[model samples]
Target: MTLLPKNPSRLIREDDRDSAVERLREAYAEGHLTHEELDGRLGRALTARTRRELGAALASLPEERAGTTSTIATAAGRIRRRGAWRVPRSLKVASAFGRVYLDLSRAVIEYPVVDIELRLGTGRAKITVPRDAIVDVEDLRTGWKDTLYKTRRRSRPGGPKIRISGIMGFGRLKIRHARR
Candidate 1:
């Protein structure tokens, strides 16, 4: 059974192609694919058009395990993460009196689901998730200001799910999904 949908003929997205390339590189580094095979697959990956072609580039490669929880806490400073950083299974962020900016739009989130725990005493916290990500903030408790999340888009069938649970004492917490 293929992982793709029944039609499976849709054009692949740029992010999907990029992810496939990273997986191929990882497989080669792990000695799973030979140099010649890697070169051949890399060409197909870079020029892959449809989902089938993209999937083929990542076929037979073993999956990477999700890492343990990562914690980033600060008393009075800035905490930021962006670029192609690897996302772990769980993330705990605590800020007493500072700004926290977490941009997960370009982050590599391999897991199907992830949990983010936040504890903001007093400061602004901005989080940007992936476009196709599903965010849940049901368990979040806030005071002084309500959490701002204006996205209504649901995650794709195989997209990632982000669950946020935490307590905000006195500040604003804004969560926005990537528009790109």
Candidate 2:
């Protein structure tokens, strides 16, 4: 999906409101809209009494795309890598689906270590990393709130390194650094 600008001047025009609504409907039908997400965006799109306000809401819609996948491993083979590592976006249907495969695999013996790197075009990112690893988070864009949560930790030599970049809208990035 193409990333829309965080602030698009075209969204405020009276003529574009209808098209924006249509796009929202399309996105909803595609199963990309969660109840909360639909309600939030719809509320903004509808409650905006002025064209400018409506435009602002429409312009803030999230967009994202998955890039490449790579594997990283150490010679000792004590550590295993998994999960999609990348920025988060509004549209995560694909990522959610991909998780099933990740869960089922016992360890493709051929590649015991795999670190998937997902390239995000735009949107929020939520990440999870192992506890034994060190985490480094960098917010490339300003004015957005990004959070990290440590869920669990194991006695290991190192931790995971997570990074977030290219945030173009108003949203939050919540990460679980370890397992509780």
Candidate 3:
């Protein structure tokens, strides 16, 4: 029996031309298509200036069956700070105070801050801080690739503070401090 519906839905919509190309590239890189097949399909996709052209190229690709869904749980509270805060996991902290805490054991973080504390656990997490924010990172677990970046010549003395802690497999923490 055919698992997919005889009349399957279109993968790429006419309005999603650019996105279709991007998705095609990702599929090709993931070995979903053979090199020869990818080369021909990629050529067609690149030359597709019109939405219809792009859609046709996308429709020609092989379909991928859906995998198991990923369950993501999250919790957030107020941190007496003036900035955008994002944490991709369940967390509990005194929001009344000017402190941000993240449990990167199962999620990635992307936000604007000056300080950062990273604790990764068996997964990859990425954080983006404001350029003027000072960064302080503490890696508690090893075997996880952790990277920290600072924007040159941008940061105020009293900027936001970031603190992260967890066990990570492959994670990244970035700090973009304010422009000087």
Candidate 4:
């Protein structure tokens, strides 16, 4: 999604609604939202047709902290987290008919190993990690012609290890070292 300045008048996309729904789920998990409130907000979020509506759905939730574990899911939009964002100890990403990007070159890692759970249905995912990081994808299961590509890079001792475990139904999952 395009990272535009906070403009109230700009149109919201389906990805925005999905993001709002995720926030609502997080709020529910954090005890900030009751079951009824989460259901109502989720309904509004799924049916929201405008950015303002989506914003309203998430207005009551607290802002996400930088270092907390986050679950990012999307139905039909792109999900990309990059740059200097903090890498959660366990990050879960689920996508369908969308694209997922996890760039960990500049991420702050607090754990010696990060667990990444990826669920992709007819979507693609690209994970870029530092050359020194170790990536283990032994638990990944793919269906049909689904593909997973890992470009080799030297892995150093004591570097963060990324353990990926998930199910892939079609599409591709590519893991590459960050370009210098």
Candidate 5:
């Protein structure tokens, strides 16, 4: 039996939804959408399970965030991102049956806010953010275990903010602040 979903085509992947959300955020930032409009569309997008629904949620938005988002996917192997990698405004990281480790301690993050969407099927994801960075996991949805994170240090006044979302199915996510 394969780890891949039997009917993968019918379900909208979490990364696609994340891209749309990021686009919506960009539109909001550029003054294309009002707060009410963004909220409504975001609610719709998050609950949408099909391509049609997702498209409808993003119906009136402009084109994508000018390619500010990138995706890294692995169906059966590990995906690791670390060191001086240039972190985009929005990143979609997905793993179907393996581990994912993303370390932003030494990464070059240009944006004030970085969005990380993680979709794990049957493995763990370890994310290490800079000590001064702030993390927000309000949008993440777990299919099995809850994410493990403990805030032991205070974030800087203007440190970068990381927004994490997506689905974790039968997997665990451990997020921590990097040690200086």
Candidate 6:
């Protein structure tokens, strides 16, 4: 008799798991989820081995329901956020062989600080922000091609700050200021 392999769960990366946890925290902070729910989902997220399991863990969260605004680009498609769109405090992007563009020049930003969690696989992400807003990409992890940020001046007072953090593989992340 031949031995067959069991149905193994689709393994998830540590960074992906961490991102899910962060989303949970944001949900809790926004008063969308209680402490008990956060704890339970966090626990489930930490132990989740498959993407489906992780997705299930966060399926019922308010942020994922209708609370936050986010964009995702996959396969060979392109995702863009421009004009007067609402900017959520927490933004998550997952791109594989796709392009993600975020133009925040005239966006309606509700939070003073925005956190962007990105996962890039052989893809690219370009972000355009207001000239006065601050941009931070220290938390980003790129491969051979390092992420780039082009700005005119340093962060000013009362300006919105964008925090970009996450993992990248064979991709590029560029941050530019919108043209006047």
User: In TM-score terms, which candidate is top?
Assistant: 1
Ordered by TM-score, highest first, the candidates read 1, 5, 4, 6, 3, 2
**lDDT of all the models against the reference?**
0.86, 0.42, 0.44, 0.80, 0.87, 0.81
Q: Between the candidate structures 1 and 4, which one is better when assessed by TM-score? A: 1
* Candidate 4 runs further than 4 Å off: 1-68, 151-153
lDDT of 1 by residue, 75-170 (tens): 999999987677788999999999999999988787899899999999989999998888899988998899999766455666688899999889
Off by over 4 Å in 3: 1-17, 60-149, 154-180
Model 4 per-residue lDDT at 89: 90
RMSD of 6: 16.1
What is the C-alpha lDDT profile of model 3 across 1-180, one tens digit per residue?
Answer: 726334434334445655565566656655677778667777877766555556667775666434322223323332222222234222322222122333332222333432232333333344444444455556334454545554456456654455544443443333344332
Query: For model 4, which pairs clash?
Result: none
Candidate 3 overall lDDT versus native: 0.44
Predicted structure 1, TM vs. truth: 0.67
Model 1 spans > 4 angstroms off: 1-20, 23-66, 153-155
Best candidate, lDDT-wise? Answer: 5
Worst 10 residues of 1 by lDDT: 1-10
Task: Output the worst ten-in-a-row residue range by lDDT, candidate 5.
Answer: 59-68
lDDT of 4 by residue, 1-180 (tens): 857556646667877876677667666765798999999889888977777778888885777776656799988999998875668899999988899999998776667999999888987889988777888888988885544556364566787888989988887888887765
**Per-candidate TM-score against the hidden true structure:** 0.67, 0.29, 0.34, 0.60, 0.62, 0.59
Ranking by lDDT: 5, 1, 6, 4, 3, 2
